[model samples]
Target: MSQHFVLIHGAWHGGWCWDGVIRELENAGHTAVAPTLPGNNPDDDLASVTFADYLDAIAAVLEQQQEPVILVGHSSAGFLLQAVAPRAAKKIAHLVFHNAFILPNGASQLDMFLPEVAQILIDAAMTVATPHGSIASPHKNVPILEDLIRNALMKDDSTEVQNALLSRLVPQPFVLFNTKVNTNDFLALNIPRTVLFCKDDRSLPPGTFLKMAQSLGTYELIECPGGHETLFIAPKIIADALTKITINPTFHAIG
Candidate 1:
């Protein structure tokens, strides 16, 4: 059966980032929609963006769909999954977290990242001081970001492909990572969930991610070959795996 897939991107990326996965999913005759979050928009005021803006954007996307969608969150969007699911629990068919971060209540994404690791992005970013916090320097830190993404986030693509991706990367707002969400009702939501783990992805340290996925109470485990950027590098694999889960969400052990 054909399914509707809503792919949510992580920081420094927009709906553009899901092109590959969308193509593969579409090829399988499944409809897919990926909404670019407020802060991630090229013309958006990064400093003014907030966590609520993201939730609103996601909710709007869910509203556009007539049928339940197989919701997929990537990277930093794992945090998005925790909050978004509870709000749109009835609209989502399944929660597919692809190499995403899963944070506890009151803890921001910064808490999940290794200080040194988070520092790399922090030190590289140039944010302007605001009443709330700060906004990042758009493309001003691309040189450092290039090295970071290559060595950390994505490792399976060619230098040329990575460069292309770097060109599209935006300097994400601090608010997106600094804000924390309440997952009290999220855990209680009865939606089926799954984690798409990339065995070779060092973007999130090994052993740590499985522990994060396990925190979801009960979730099916799906493993595949590739790194944190597995969705881009291996779209067919991801699309196929998502198809399987959306069709039959069976309980399994963490990969």
Candidate 2:
């Protein structure tokens, strides 16, 4: 049977990042669409973008599908799945978190990171802030350092590949990280959820990604090999894993 997938990209990346994955999915007789969220474009105004913009953009995409799609989010987009689920439940057949963040209700993405790591991101955001009288607000967005990307996201890839990846990245809107969300309505929905974890992911502390996946209460666990940027580094592998997991509905329950 043929299936439609709506792939959402993580922070600092545009929908182009999923080109490889989309190709593999299409080759398998499956259809997919990867939409670059608002503010991710090179010319977009980062400061004006809010958390709601991301939700609205994603919701719009889901609403347009003729049939319910296998909604998949990568990296920070995991929370986007939670936030959009309540409003677009009927449009989503399953929730796939590809090494994505799953935040608790009312908690910001920053809260999920270790203090030191979180501070580094916060400080990076502050560095590009625009002065607002006595206070400063993050306006230029958070820039991902090359070393950090090479070490955490594409550690296993070649320098040329890493450099190519870095050249395409845009600053991520800081507001996306600091915004708190409530997933009460989402939690109540009976939609199927899956955590497609890349085992080699080193962006967060070891075991952190799985811990976040555990918070889904009941979810299908699909582990593959790659780091945080597996979607870009090993698209075929990620696509294969996605195809396999969505073929069945077996899930593991947690407390």
Candidate 3:
């Protein structure tokens, strides 16, 4: 059976992040759509982007789908999807998290990270400056905190891939990380959910995701071998996991 998928990219990443996965999904006879989040890329003004803006982008994509689609979110996007999923639950068949955060009601992305991790981010943002002599949000260079992104996202990747990603990376709005989500209603919807944890992810550790799954109560946890940027590092593993979820609706627990 052919399934429709809506792939949501994480912070500092745009829709182009899913290019590799889209090709694999399409080859398997599935329909896929990757929408660029607001405030990502040179054409978009990062200063004006907000969490609601990202929700609108996902909602718009959901509106265009004729069938209930599988909505997949990576990295920071998990929170955004959690906020939008309830409203679009009727149109969404499943929720997939790829090395992403899955916060409960009234929780923010910062809540998922350790207190020290949050502090590091806050402190870093205080020192980040843009070319115009203005302070840019630290989230713009998420890869800087971890050695992996510095090694993988910008350097290890092919020249074409690195350029494409670099063009889309933007200073994420600070409010998005602090915004509280009212996910109580969303959790109650009981949509089938899955989490694919990349073992080598240096961004948000796998332990955080495991805690999220426990709090969520119902989810399939699948472990893959790669970094936080597995969409680029291990697209085949991700595609295979998606295929498993699509075909076996009842397989709710993995990893």
Worst window of 10 by summed lDDT in candidate 2: 129-138
Tens digits of per-residue lDDT for model 1 on 1-255? 889999999888889888888999899998898889986777877667778989989988998889888899998889888998888877898888888888777788878888987786566555544588767665333122667788777666789878877888887877666677787768788788888887888876678888877678777888888887777666788888888783454654444
Tell me the lDDT of model 2 at 214: 72
Instruction: Indicate which candidate wins on lDDT.
Output: 2
Of 1 and 2, which scores higher on TM-score? 2
Candidate 3 residues lying further than 4 Å off, grouped into runs, are: 124-148, 151-168, 246-251
What is the full ranking by TM-score, best candidate first? 2, 1, 3
Tens digits of per-residue lDDT, candidate 3, 124-195, equal 555665677746554433323433345533444555665555555655666667778887777777688888
Q: Per-residue lDDT for 132-159 in model 2, tens only?
A: 4323444747887777788877878889
| Colliding pairs, model 2 | none
Question: Each model's C-alpha lDDT?
Answer: 0.79, 0.87, 0.73
By the TM-score metric, which is better: model 1 or model 3? 1
Clashing pairs in 1: none
Off by over 4 Å in 2: 129-140, 247-255
